[model samples]
Structures are given as C-alpha cells and as structure tokens.
Target: MAWYYVENNESVGPVQESDLHALSQQGKITAQTMVCRQGDTAWVPFAQAFAPGSAAVAVADPAGAPRVSHSCVMCQKSVTADDAVQLSGNWVCATCKPLYLQKLKEGATISGVRRYAGFWIRVGAKIIDSLILMMVTIPFQFIATALIPGANDPKAIGAVIALAVVTNGFNILSNLAYQVFFLGKYAATPGKMVCKIKVIRSNGAAVTYGRATGRYFAEILSGLTLGIGYLMVAFDEEKRGLHDRICDTRVIYKD
Candidate 1:
C-alpha cells in the first residue's frame, strides 16, 4: 500500500499498501493511479503493493538540464491555473475554451485545441430564424386583434379565442416540427437547404432535442437587436450566426 502523485502524467508512488488502501477508500486515490512494485516492469493501481522508494525515478533530460515541462493537453494554454474554468486535469487558453467545449459537447475528445463555430455564424442564424418566426406570427396577430373585431363579444368570442389559440399554438408546433423533423432529420430548413448549408454538432454527431431547444431559444437573443447581432455573422471568423453559437451548433457545407 502507498501513495503517489500523478502530475503531468507521470506517477510517483509506493508509499504503503495499507495507506494506499486507506487512501483509495478515503477517495484520495483513484483506480487510474499507476502503482507498481519494485523490480516490476509493469505498473498497477493503488490497490497493489509495492516496495517503498520504488516509484521515484531520475526523470531523464536530453542535456541534463532542468526540463521546461510542456502541457499534457496542449501548449501554453494554462486554463485551470489562470482562468477560473477548472474544467479538468488539462489546461487550455481562454480563446480555446469555447472551441474545446464544442468538441466535448459533440462527444469528441480533442487533444490541445480545435476551432468550432465562431460568434457570427451562431448569432446570424438566430437572427434569421427569429425573423422567420415573426413573419409567420404577424399575420396571425393581425387576424386576431384587428380583423376579428369585438373579440370579447360572447357570440363571436369563442371563434376569436379558437383562432388565437390555434395561432399561438402554431409557433410551438412550427418550432418543434421544423427543428426536430427538418433540422434534426434533414439537417437544414428551406432557406438553409437552399443556401447549401447544414447544421451539425461540432463533432459531426446527430443533433439532439436539447441542442435543438437551445437553438430555438437562442433565436430570441438574435431578435433582440432587430437581427443586427445575427447579421454580425458576415464578419465572424467561423461565420456563425448568434443562434448557432448559442446552441453550440455549426452551419457548414451541405455536402
């Protein structure tokens, strides 16, 4: 039984078998610990017994100089240290957090960092979709408030109520139907399809309902600024519209 520190991927161990078991049960040691006994070529977990002083080794260097340790996950992206992210054992630069997160959300394990959707494409898509929703709703509103007068009239109120209910329900139906069936199933809407674009997970996995819901609500943010925020996609690095970023989605080539 013993204890070891697994920093930077190297293990220093062989404390005491009883101590190791106690640490394991106390949650100090994990199954991933690489403990090994003296004269053993292979490493085992903390649960195994090992000779004291067996884990320490002379970390060799090319020039016998102090090694400038490089990050296990990537370059100088010290995420957990400087930033308050505290994501995991690895570190990442602030600029790379979103990119790394997107890959993670999509079920991809990327070492270091990789780019995902940028601010523009995510925002812009949201703006456009919200506008489309508004366009769809305007007619319904007009018909409910203006065209149908005396909405409070008992005799005709029922009809007006029915119309309003149907109209209100349409937005929800459209959102669910279009997103689940068209976006999820076909990967695009009429406009997106026509533009030869498709929405996909950053890791290229199938879209899920939760992600689609995020995209759906993100439309409101884009609409908040009359779609100016959405139009910002034209200048974004990833060409992401607002909604795309909000949903952690990307619009890419259809093919």
Candidate 2:
C-alpha cells in the first residue's frame, strides 16, 4: 500500500510501503513520525503502524468526529492535535505541557536529541580559530610596532614595554570581539562552522551577545586550570568543557 508521512509538520507523500520502510531505516522517518496508509482516516506513529502484529488505530473525538493523532514532541504520547499544544513548531500533549513549559522557563533542551561534540573535534576547531586569530594579529603587531617611536631601539626599554602592553591589549580585545560576535550572531565561529559544530545554551537556544562575552571570559578559567577544564569534555556525560559548564552552554554537531 502507498503511505504518507508527516515531515516538519506537513504531509509528505504517497510512496510505496517499501519506500516508507527504507526511509525509516535511513533515519529520514523517526519512530514518532506520523504516518498513514492510503485511504486511512487518521494518522498514527510509524512504530505503531509497523510494529509486529500491530495495526494502525484510528481515533475519534468524543462527539464522534474523525480525529488524527500525533506524537507529543516532549513525552512521545499519542495525542490528537486538538488536544495538544504547539510550542516552537513541536507538539506537546496536555499531560506534558506543564513540564515542557517549565523546561522552557529554565532554559533546558526539551527534546534532548542534541549530539554533543567530542573533545578531539572541539580541539580541532579551537586550533583552526587560533590560526585565524594569528593571521589577524600578526599584521596588527607589525603596524603597531612601526607606528611606535623607538620601537626598533633595543636601548629604549620604556618604549618597548609600552609597545608590548599595547599589542597584548589589542590582541585580547580582538579575540573577545571575534568570539562574541560569531557566537552571538552565528552560534559558531568560522572554525566551528568548518568543523560543523556550534555553541548553544543548555536549552538549545542560540547564544546571546552577553552570554557569548561571558563564555569567552569563562574560557580563561579553562586555561588557568592547565587545560583541565577543556579536558572535562572527554569524560563528561554531555561532553561539556569547564567553560561550557560554567556558562551553561553546549557544543553540538550541526547535523
């Protein structure tokens, strides 16, 4: 029989049942994805429809009107759309609505489907960022040195000291601005983008400029601890570094 599935809250297609099974195996259709066969009056979950010896069940409203059931994005319970609330484009049944709202208020990832980035991958991204920063700072260092009087005079200790301080300050501010702007606006630096990962809040929301600034400072704690903070990702259940834990952030794969 031909089958149809819901994707991104829209009905997808009338493909052969074999094709539907292929989609499910390929991870294109999740167990909770709504599916219906041709001429079916109601939609049911892929698991319910395909379970061994199970048949798709049609639900009817109390007033005897035909109704379609959807899986709650939070609790995974079958609920008719009329009885469920939509939050951020995902469905939550009446039973889970309160808990879902509480999670939202507390800034937690409601669905918990994020794939945390591992330490090695994070290190790779950091290396890339460092290289980019080096490229930017090297030129600025040359320009600053050329502009400063007596910069090339080995005897001018005070002038050399002043140049060093100015150069270091510029590097610090530039690094901060780079991280804050990218994390706040794109949720990833160019390095993280190349690595296909991004930083987000524990709630799965994009990082804000203020939070990004704080997180950049928090990373200093990671460095101060002799890199133990970053090492935490290798052992932590959520793959969180010290900065991630301190800032309540996560590094997760984009896909």
Instruction: State which candidate has the highest TM-score.
Output: 2
- Report the error of model 1 at residue 196, Å: 1.7
What tens digits encode model 1's per-residue C-alpha lDDT throughout 233-253?
A: 666655666776677676675
Least lDDT summed over 10 consecutive residues: which range in candidate 2? 59-68
Once model 2 is optimally superposed onto the true structure by TM-score, how far is the C-alpha of residue 143 displaced, in angstroms?
0.5
Per-residue alpha-carbon lDDT of candidate 2 for residues 1-255, written as tens digits (9 for 90 to 100): 887787777677779999998999999998988787765546788898888897778634322233456677777776655568866545688888998889878877655445689999998999999999999899989998999999879999988998899899989999999999999999999999999999998766889999999999999999999999999999987888999999999999886
**What lDDT does candidate 2 reach at residue 7?**
79
Q: Which residue pairs overlap in candidate 2's backbone?
A: none
lDDT of 1: 0.57
Which lDDT values do the candidates have, in the order given?
Answer: 0.57, 0.84
Clash number for every model? 20, 0
